[model samples]
Target: MSQSVLPQSIKELQHLLWTAADSDYPVYVYREGPQDGVIIDLSKLNEIIEIDPANLVATVEPGVKLGALAKKLAEQGLRFIPADTLFYQDKTVGELFYEGCSTISSLKYGCTKHFLMGSEVVLPSGEILKTGGKTVKNVTGYDFTRFFNAPYTDFGITAKYLLKLLPVPETRKSVSVSFKGIAELLAFIKDLKASHIVPAYLLWVDLGEQSVFRTDSSGQLVMMEFDGLSEEVSEQWKNTEIFIKKYKGAIYEVSDGCSEMASKWSCLYRTTDKYVLTEEIKMPFTAQGEFYKIFYEKAKASRVKASLFGQLAEGKLNIVFAENYPQDTFIENIIEAVEQAGGVSSGKYGRLTGKRPAGILAELEHRAKIALDPKMILNR
Candidate 1:
């Protein structure tokens, strides 16, 4: 079992890093997985350092939970765009930023990286590195902020963050319509893309027996969320209804608050005994239909129960598989199908089949790691 440490202050964290480096002890920032060495938990560092309503910026500690921050910001008529999804509210600010978490709102505000303006990170060498600042446009030097955006390699541990904020929308609404098949759904999506009305997110959910969002009937649900001034949202909904009627879609639900729909949508991320495996697939809009057809056909042929949900505009899909399924061969087959359909799969299975970046980019990453953690004690 790995030992866990919670540093109370930046100085203590630096000291711990220095000691670990000197002793060649592996140190890891706590994430969801098994660890072989020391685990650094940042929960004690939680704090909402500052909220500048005038500038619409928030300075926060790594351990601050996003849900708490949202409530606090809402008090000031402000919100963090990428965290609009109610589910993300449960995650800490640091976890969301470091993991590059995105939500249905990503269609409008982009991802977590777009909202991050600056950060203070503690290097594995115990050196404190500051990048960006309170201002939105602070381009200078090497743009080290980008380097620390996701930090999949655990290059450094973030201590503080400067995040961008936006005013809370006056009204939020959602519309769900069910389509009998993928072709009809795709046609509706194509029209929505060309229309002047833009949604906060357009989700395509495929309901199956194992899906938490499954209904008495199995089919596809296209959900669109609109948020803005009340008049604007009302207008968008009007235009959306026209498209739904044109596509011969059966209106499943129309919600004014959007809370109920968002809650149900969050079930896509939930895991259960029956639904044990999940994978994210990214492809072009043109290839999305083919990819889905091929993937679902394979699953059906193999007797594997699977369901899918994803952002339609983003061309990203999440597939959930039944427990104790033939994941190895199934995943390999899916990856092959994704490539054939002109797309890519990501997750543990995809990583094994994906090729790493080569040449100068690879060398630069290597040098950066070596320079920041010469002893290689961080996240060892």
Candidate 2:
């Protein structure tokens, strides 16, 4: 933990940055609390600066919660589709980009970085660094507005963000399906993909070994979400029902009216957070069958009780296990295996680094950081 400072206004924020630049200790931009080093709490920077409904864009402070901002945008019949799976009620826009939160809809909508139009950053040198522009397509220069995708800290404090928005979909629906076996489930997913129905999300869930579904069920739960025009959604729903029935699998549809999608997504997201250690494995969807085979075998051999969930569309597997399980060694082995199999894994709570950067690339990153934070006093 580090000392905390709350800046109520931009001037105060600038002064705090000046003090941090002069100090010997590193400073971290803090939202909820001090993540590391000294804390620069930006919670007071909560504000919805501007909303252009015509352009489907909004300028918001870093501290504004996604849920609150969504509601504000919804008032104008627009939505900020976040890159977070569960739509966490308390999660802020800053934390999403700063922490690089992964989302279920990433396969279709792309990641959080795509939604970021611009930002205002308070560099560690006590100077403001504004990047990007207010428009959607600004390819002016280096995308300094983009997140670094590290868990520790950014080069500076994120003050404000310009977010791209979308009109609230006219319809939204989710379908949950259970298969008789893993092979059967994979086959169904393969068929669904070939059918060309683009669901908002397709997630695979492990119901746990103790659950009733464990004994009587297929040991796999696949959830699919679809949102768009009413007619298209209805047609897809019907086709999906027929397709599932073709495999003799159980299917249930939960429309957006019940808010069931959010509830279920939240439940799965919470399971990952409840555990002490978790690692996300990313691979091609085609290799999921072989990858999961190796994954389960390793877990069984290690006697580790692991919960599994995946963003099926993007082929990202999220594995969560209790603290009692072998953490370091197991994760290292898993990462090695995943890489050997042409997959990628970022150990326990960080963005996946597909591969290690080369010497010059790594050096460039370091030089860029130093150029912005010469003292390394802002969240080293």
Candidate 3:
């Protein structure tokens, strides 16, 4: 494996990139490594540059941790919404946007790209480039801000960012419900949709035979989170309770609170380091039930222990398999099923930043890479 470079300042980073551009070595940027060749470690750059409460925007260094920033914002009665579906406390703001992470709140707040107002990046040629502006209504030439979101460091390293913020909700409540079967879970969700109940996020998860928590019942769990004024959250909770009861599902307040909910959701969503075979499937909302139906049957037939979970409103599915599972054919079956359902698969979960399939999207990325990193010294 190649060594790494830890730059403390933007000038140092640019110099490193410039030298790399002059060389034949490939460059890669990551917070942690196994990143081969020239690895750029950005840990020292963690800083919250500015927080403008009046404008509801914050400018932060790429290395700023998501949890830390959220806490800082919380002190001001604000929140930094991330697009990541799971709450990874250690994830940096740069990593979140670079990887195009999604959060359960995506149903209401949109993805990581949506909150990104602008960014400062060091091009592979060691030149500094800024895209977009602090204002939300910026109408730039090409809107390269969106293009750079989750570019996999193939174009450049995001050095700084301007992120939008939201006022913190007065109250937050989470409900965890258990269902005996997929049919029951589906019924509950159908009712939930029909009732026009919009929670911050609604997640349905089924960690098969090898699940770690609450496994005694061997049933699926659905978790819903509501945030707003106290009265509003209370009303939503009341409606949710009645709707869940009609399907005979048991509901309970998430005892520990939002932090606990985030931890549990992250645990369920992320594959253990031991299990490297993980996949993500995203489909249209209309096709979720059918996809799940087919997925469960195939998973059963294959006897692969699959931990399945998704954002109900957003129509995204995540599955993590055991380390030694037969992955090739299994993934093929999954892709085929997803395609049949008029859905798309991101292939690997968090790692694959490019959501579009490899043809046109690949071509576009190639062109963008050339435009931004002409030296081809960046991640390839």
The weakest ten consecutive residues by lDDT in model 2 span 348-357
lDDT of each residue in 222-329, candidate 2, tens digit only: 787888899999998888887788877776556663246346556444434345326777888778778777877787787666656777667788776654334556
The number of clashing residue pairs in each candidate reads 0, 2, 9
Instruction: Give per-model TM-scores.
Output: 0.89, 0.87, 0.90
| Higher-scoring candidate on lDDT, 1 or 3 | 1
Instruction: Report, for every candidate in turn, its global Cα lDDT versus the true structure.
Output: 0.76, 0.69, 0.73
Which candidate leads the pack in lDDT?
Answer: 1
Give one digit per residue, the lDDT tens place, for model 1 in 13-130: 9898888888888887745324567889999888899999888899998998887898899899999876666666667888776654556678776866778888899888788999
The regions of model 1 sitting more than 4 angstroms off are 32-35, 208-217, 270-278, 301-303, 324-326, 346-363
After the best TM-score superposition of candidate 3, give how far the Cα of residue 121 lies from its true spot, in angstroms: 1.0
Candidate 3 lDDT, tens digit per residue, 1-380? 77877799989988898888888567777533344577788888998999999888899998888878888888898877772234556778777766555666887677667788888888888888888877856736788887776635368888989998899877878778888777778777777778877888777777445452444445777777888888988887888888778888866456424645455556653435645425767788778767777876887787766656777667787766655354567777888999999988765543443344467877788787788777677765
Determine which window of 10 residues in candidate 3 has minimal summed lDDT. Answer: 348-357
lDDT of 2 at 310: 77
Report the candidate with higher lDDT, 1 versus 2.
1
Poorly placed runs, candidate 2 (over 4 Å): 30-36, 83-86, 147-153, 208-218, 270-273, 324-326, 347-360
- Give me the overall lDDT of model 1: 0.76
